[model samples]
Structures are given as C-alpha cells and as structure tokens.
Target: MISRRLRETAVAGPFLSVKGLVFGLFILVPFVYTFILTFQRGSLLTGMRWGGLSNYRTVVTDTLFRDALKNTLLFMLVCTPVTLVVSAAVGLLLSSSLRGMAVHRALIYLPSLLSVVATGLIWKVLLDPEQGPLHLLMLRGFGLDVPWLTNGTVAIVLLAFITAWSTCGFYGLVFMAAFNGIDTELLEAARIDGAGPWQVLVQIKLPLIQPVAQVVLALLTINCVQVFDLVFVLTNGAPGTATYTAMWYVYQNAFNGGSVAYAATMSVMLLILTALISALFLARRTGADADA
Candidate 1:
C-alpha cells in the first residue's frame, strides 16, 4: 500500500506543481502587483513615488470615472435581465421538436462565433447613417434616416442591443443544457394538473432553473461591467462620453492618460464590485438550495 501510494504521488506531483507555477506567475502575480501599484504614482519614464490613497481619491472624484461607472451600471441593469429572458426564450424554442430547429439554433449561434472586433466592425458598417446598407435600405424603403451612432442615447441602446445579440446565443446554449437536465416527470405532472403552458413555464420550469439563471445573471453582470472591446471598436465612448465603460476608463488612464496608479485603483474597485455581485448570487443560491 505505501509503495503504491508513493507511485501515485510521484505521478501527480509534477503536474500539480506545473499548474500552480503557471497560475502563480500569471494570475496571482499580476493581481498582487496591481494591488501594490494602486498606492504608487508614476509611469515608466518617471520614478515612482508612494502616494497612499491619493490615486483612489482621484479615481473616486473624477467626473469621467463617475460617468464611466454610471454607464457601466446602466448597461448591467438593462442588459442582464434582457439577455436572461431572451436566452431563456431562445433556449426553449431550440429545445423544441419542431422541424429545422437545429438549423435555426445554428444560425442564431453563428454571430457569437465571430471575434468581438469583427462583430463590432460589422455592426459599425451596418449602422452607418449615410452610406451603410441598413441605412440605405431604411431610407429607400421607409424614407427615415436613423441616427444610430451620432446620438448618445441611441448609441448606448445600440451598444446594449449589439451586446445582447452577440451574447444571447451562448447563454441560450447554457439555458438549453439546464432545460434538458430538468425532469420530464415534473413537467408532465404540471400539465396533468390542468396547468396551461404559460403556467408550467412560469411556475415550474423557471423555478427549477433558478440556479442556472442566477449563474448566468452573475456572469452577464461581470461581462457588462467590464465591457470594453465592443465600446472601443464601436463608439470609442463617443457622443460625448455617453457610452464610456469602467474598463474603457481604466484603459484610458493606464495607457493614454499616463495615470497607471489611478487606473489600478479603479481596477480594484471594479474587482470589488464584481466580487460582491458574485457573492450575492452565490449566497442566494445556497439559501435557496438549503430551503429546498
């Protein structure tokens, strides 16, 4: 027994060591360095000086940071619920036995396979007010010129819509898996109790899928809070900073504005927010499971 245990340990020890080393070098080291940098001020060209919490103070008081926070929160509030609902609907539809449903599911999921840069560029061209195909079609067909990128409110809405469009398919796939795992006996029991389709969906299906929904909500919340690539490629936070996100602000400060310390401070705040959201969702999930 001891000789066999020694052999098993020898086999597993090297792989575990490599995994720990890689994780430490990448995630743990960077996280610790960023946290340390939040207290220091300077760029590569300038010598660093300890600034205590001044970087955090500046980040909290900056108007641009506030705007970025507001936009990020707004995006989270609006997009997460909408994405959840749409994903659930799509998942239910795809899980049906209707003919050609597989093809429809594939088509819907195709957009998510595109790179974020490609997705943004494609939508940017399609939404051009003057010369794009969408605009031209609307102009000729309905005689209306829609200002998609030029208006602040409309631009934010478009960003949210595009984000949902690109991400819903992936979430739909997740939901479909959850839907598939549900017990068919429960659904049949609900149907036999004179429950209509809507009643079964609302009371039975949704309740059973709450755990998956919570996970999706937490993930979408983090994604929305950290949204940057689409905003960068699409609006560049234009229309007077209307669509600027927290991550975009972090990038601007760290790279363009030469405020790396402040950027690190903001990054910490975003991290805290994401952590809190995840914690809340997990707590709720745990409590619900215990009650059940």
Candidate 2:
C-alpha cells in the first residue's frame, strides 16, 4: 500500500511539486534561516558575523536575563495554579443546575473574549492611583493609594491576577467539558456508597479529570512563560525589571532594541524551556497511564 501511494504521488507530479515548494518555503526555509541567525553576531542594523557561542553565553550570564527568567518562572508559579483552581471551581458551579446559570456563565466568560491589549488598558485605567475606581475604593477602605503597577512585587501579583481573570473563562470551559464527560453512574454509585458531594468531587471527579487538569497546567505554563502583550501594554517591564519576562526581553532585543541575534538566542532558550516542561508533563502522564 505504501509503495502504491508513492507511485501514485510520483505520477501526480504537479500537485506534489506545488506541495513540496510550499512546504520548503513556509516551514523548512524559515526554520533554517532562524537557526542560522541565532548564532549571527553584530548589530541587527549594521552587519552579521559568526559569533559561535558568544550570544548564548552573553544571554545566560546577563543579569537582566537572570531577572527575566526569575520573573517568568514566578509568574507561571502564581498564575497557573490560581487559574486552575478558579477555573475548576467555576466549572463545578456551572455544572450544577443553579438559577440564572446562563447569565452567570456569560458574565464569567466575558473577560476571555476581550483582546489582551484592551484588557490591559482597561485594568491600567482602573488601577490608576489618582482617579481609578479600584484605587478610590482601596484608598477609602485602607486610607492608602497603592501603586498597582508601580511597585515591583505588587505589579507582578497584579499581572498574575489579570492573566488569571482573562484566561479563567477558557480553562473553565475546558474543565466544564471534562466534568460533563464523566459517567453519571459513577456519581450515583458514590452517593449510594454514602459519599457526600465533597467526597464524590474530591475522590471520583478530580481523579477522573486528572488528565485534563494536567493538560490545562501544561498549556497554562506555556502561556505564562510566553506572556508579553498585556505586560508590555501595562507595565513595559517597569519597576526596575521586576516584570520583565523572557518573552518581554526577547521582544525588546528583537524588535524594539534591534538586537536580532540576541533575541533569536533568547527565543531558542524559551523554546528549550517550553519543550522541557512539556516533556516532563507528558512523561508523568505516560507513566500514570502505564500504571493504570
């Protein structure tokens, strides 16, 4: 069958030729170019030189790179779990046949529909120190105006919160779908065994949905690590590089600051980190499946 297909492909030469051309131009060429440019030295504007491992060493040893790595990891640590928790809770609530559930779901999911730039701008205004609604409320309540985006620690936390609120709807939908896929009989069996709602959820539902949760976590980790748009629009890696994520730094070097080779190196590093995290999660899943 494989030999017959190959013979047929060879006979249908034009279509196959076009496909080969498209694949080379779209995938192979760009990948080879980017890989080559990663090792290129000199300013993006002036010229290109072969720098060997210098770009990699410079990026690794730079203090800004270290800070970006720390900040990116911290953001993921805060955002991923918070998103999963809030999303799972919301999914559970949505699964229940509560009153006005449609309205509740719509309202909860609304933020995810907004563009990240729009959401960031809205939050920036809302978090303004002098005249924002949240600022006024906090000032009245606590007798102080906290700089939501000005302070290093506070900015990081606030960025996480914004990311969580924006992404919770999408993850909530995923969890809800997973929740709905469970066999209804399992819940009845648990109840028949004198299991309460909490027990049924914790023991039966959660364990059954563990795979989905793991997928969500992996995706959330990727998103958190690659985050840039909202951070750029809101803080621009302010407060002395406190919110500078790896992607943010990469963007600065590649486009904003004209360090194309360095940006390419950072891009490769991010790819490596993402691949490692994805592999770890996949391995755990495979191991669990094998045991099962």
Candidate 3:
C-alpha cells in the first residue's frame, strides 16, 4: 500500500510542478521584470542600470505627468458616475415587461461587442469637425460647430461620453443579471406597504443590489485608469496634452518616446494607484459590512 501511494504521489507531483512553472513563467516573471525595470534608468535597448529613486522622482516632478494624472482622474470622476447611472437606468428600463425588449437590449449592447479600434474610428468620422454627419447636423440645426476632438476640455468630455456610451449597455446587462436575482416577494411586500415604484427602487431595491454596484464601480475605476485605445485613436493625446492619459503617457515613453524606464515607472505608479483605490474600496465595504 505504501509503495502504491508513493507511485501515485510521484505521478501527481510532476503535473503540479509543471502547472506551477507555467504560471510563474507567464505571470510572476513578467511582474518581477516590470518591477525591476521601473527603477532602471537606461532605455529598453541600452540595458538597465540601477537608478534607485531617479525614475520615481522624474514621474513625480514632471509637468506632463501631472497633466496626465489630472486628466485621468477627471475622466474617471466624470465617466464612472455617468456610466453607472446610465447603465442602471437602462437595466431598470429593460427589466420590465416591455415589448421587443430583447431587440432593444441587443441594439444597445452591440457597440460594446465591436473592437475598440472600430468604435474609435466610427466615432472619429461621426465627430469630424467640418463635414461629419454629426457636426453637419449640429451646424445646420443649432449653428454650433462643436470641435468635439479639437478642444482640450471638450475633447475630454467627448472621451467620457464615448467611453460611457460604448460600455454602458454591457454594464446594463450586468445590472440586469443582478436585478433578476432579486426576490419578487420583497418587491411585492414593498408595494403592499404603499411604496411606489420610485420609493421601491430608491429605498429598497437599490440597497439590495449594493454588492453588484460595488463591483461595477471597482471595475469601472480600473478600466478608467487603464484607458488607452480610445485616446490613442481619437485625439492621440493632442491639443497640448489635454487628453494625455496615464496609460497613453506610459505607451509613448515605452515605445514612441524611447523612455522605457520612465514609462515603466509611470506604469508602476498606475499600479500603485489601482492598488490604493482597491484598498480604499475594500475598507469602505468592510466598514459598511460591520455597520450592517
């Protein structure tokens, strides 16, 4: 029996070791390399030299870094709330017994299925300043030539709008899934207690779905911080660094600007920001849980 058990254990050990090795090579090794490169001074090709706090200092003191951080934060602040609200609204609207709801939901969610590049291109054409359909319509109807992608503040707002519009339907589906899980009996009880639809949604239903909302907020925050493709395709961080996001800066430094070490450092700062946000969210949730 002991000999048989030893043979089985030996057979399993190799498989387990292989799995561990694969994970380490793919995940752990990359993470460690990034951390090391974050502190290196030389470019990607010239090889790394220990620069200690130099990279971090550059990231902290650079004016462009400040602008990128500010813009990124502002985008998050505006878009996160708008997406959550709009998605929740759509979810609530579709959760009813409306006719042809499936088709409507599909139409709304279809944009999210498209590639980011495709969405960006479509919007870029639609929002063209001079002759684009949207611009032409606005000019003809309202006599406003809104330079959606040319101006700094307006461009940032446009980015927020585009991001929210593209992704809200997907989030709506998320909220719908959570809404479906809710007990009908609770809603019925609320109605019996003279609670109207608005009251039920506000005072009862929304509270019940807090967990889903928390998850959505966390996910959106992370996505906002890592936003790159839309900024790249639409404005390319133009208008004097107005739409210059943290990730865009990282990308430029890493590839375009030949500042790999600085980019790595920026990436590390973004990672730290993400971790801090996650920590704050966890702490808030813990406090709420304790109160309950």
Candidate 4:
C-alpha cells in the first residue's frame, strides 16, 4: 500500500508543481506587482517613483473617478437583481421537460457564446438612433425618435439591459443546474401537500437554491462592476461620461490619460470592492447554511 501511494504521489507531484508555478507566474505575480505599482507614480515610458498613497488620494479627488464609481455602483444596483431574477425565471421555465426544450435552451445560451465585443457591436448597431432597425422601426412605424445611445438615462438603462441579455443565458444555465439538482421527491411531496407553483418556487425551490443564487449574485456583481469591453464598444463612455464605468476609468487613466500608477490605484480599489462584496455574500451564505 505504501509503495502504491508513493507511485501515485510521484506521478501527480510534477504536474501539481508545474500548475502552481504557472499560476504564480501568471496570476499571483502580476497581482502583487499591480498592488506595488499602485504606490508608485509614473507611466511605463517614464520611470516610476514611489508616491505612497498619493495615487489613491488623487483617485479619491478626481471627478472622473467619482463619476465612474457612481456609475459602476448604479450599474451593479440595476443589473444584478434583474439579471438574477430573469435568469432564475428563465431557468425554471426551461427546466420543464417539454418537447423542443433543448432547442430553446440552445437559443437562450447562444448570446453568451458570442464574444463581448461582438455582443456590444451587435447591440450598438441595433440601438443606433438613426439607421438601426429598432430605431428606424420606432421612428417610421410609430413616429418616435428615441435616442437609445444619445440620451444619458436611456443610454445607461439600455446598457444595463444589453448586459443582462448577454449574460442571462450563462446564469440561466447555472440556475438550471441548481434547479435540476433539486430533489423531485420533495417537490412532489409539496405538491401533494397542496402547494401551488408560486408557493413551491418561493418557499421551496428558492430556499433550496440559495447557495447557487449567492454564487450567481457574486459573479454578476463582479462582472457588472468590472464592465468595460461592452461599454467601450457600445457607448465609449459617451453622452458626457454618463456611462463611464470604473474599469473604463482605469483603462483611460492607464492608457489614455497616461497615469499608470493612478490607474493601478483605481484597479486596487475595484479589487478591494469586489473582494468585500464576495466576502459579504459568502458570509451570508455561511450564516444561512448554519441556520438551516
């Protein structure tokens, strides 16, 4: 038994060592370097000098950063709950064993398979105020000229909806798996005990799927907070920076504004925010599980 165990260890040890080395080189090292960079002032072209927390102070005082932070928080507030609820509802609906359900599921998930840039470009075209199909239809058919991307409020709302549309399929898949994992016997018992569909969903299925919901919520929150690519392609933080997000601000500072250290500071702040949100969700989940 000892000899066999040693043989297994020998086979696995090298692979595990290589994996750890790769992880450290790619993820761990870059993360530490980024954190360190946040304390320095200078672009990549210009030599860096230690600035301590001055970069962070600059971020706190910058109006652009403040706008970005506010917009990011707004996006999370609007997008997260809508995404979760819609995904869960769609997942529950699609979980039914109906004919052509597989086709429906595929259709729903197809959007998620598209690249972020592709998704954003598609929505950009669709929502174009002048020549886009939806815009033209509204204008020609109903005599309404709704500026989807030009109006600040409309632009933000449209971005949130498009984001939700793009991501809901993936979350739907997660919820579907959670729903399928639910014991059918318990559902049957609830039905036999005179539970309606609404009651079963609200009182049983939701409670049972709390852990999955928590995970989805955390992921969605992080994604919403870090949103950049889609916004970059779709609106480019247009209409006077109304739609500018925190990640967009980071990118702008690093690449466009030539404030790499300030960008690093913003990045670190975002990372801290994401970690805190995730930790809160995890704590709630732990408490709920303990109570159960």
Cα lDDT tens digits for candidate 4, 1-292: 9999999999999999999999999999999999999999877886899988898888778998888888888888888889999999888978889899999999999999999999988877877776789888999999988988787677777788888998899999989999999999999999999999999999999999989999999999999989999788988899889889999988988889668888888999999999999999999999998998
Measured against the true structure, the TM-scores of the candidates, in listed sequence, are 0.96, 0.91, 0.92, 0.96
Q: Report the Cα lDDT for candidate 3.
A: 0.89
Whichever of 1 and 4 has more lDDT, that candidate is 4
Give the per-residue lDDT of model 3 (tens digit) for 68-159.
Answer: 98999888988999999999988887788889999999998998998888999999899887668999899999998897988988888888
Model 4, runs deviating above 4 Å: 1-6
Candidate 2 on 1-292: residue-level lDDT in tens? 9999989978998888999999999988987787788889888569899999888999878999899989988888889899999999988888888999999989989999999999999998898877899999999989887879888888888899899999999889889889999999999999999999999999999999999999999999999989999888999999878889999999988888667888888888888999999999999999888988
In candidate 4, residue 84 scores what lDDT?
A: 95
lDDT of 2 at 158: 86
Which 10 successive residues of model 1 have the least lDDT summed?
149-158
Clashing residue pairs in candidate 3 (N, C-alpha, C atoms within 3 angstroms): none
Compared to the true structure, candidate 3 yields what TM-score?
0.92
Mark the 10 consecutive residues where model 4 has the least summed lDDT.
122-131
Each prediction's RMSD to truth: 1.4, 2.6, 2.5, 1.4
Candidate 1 lDDT at 165 equals 92
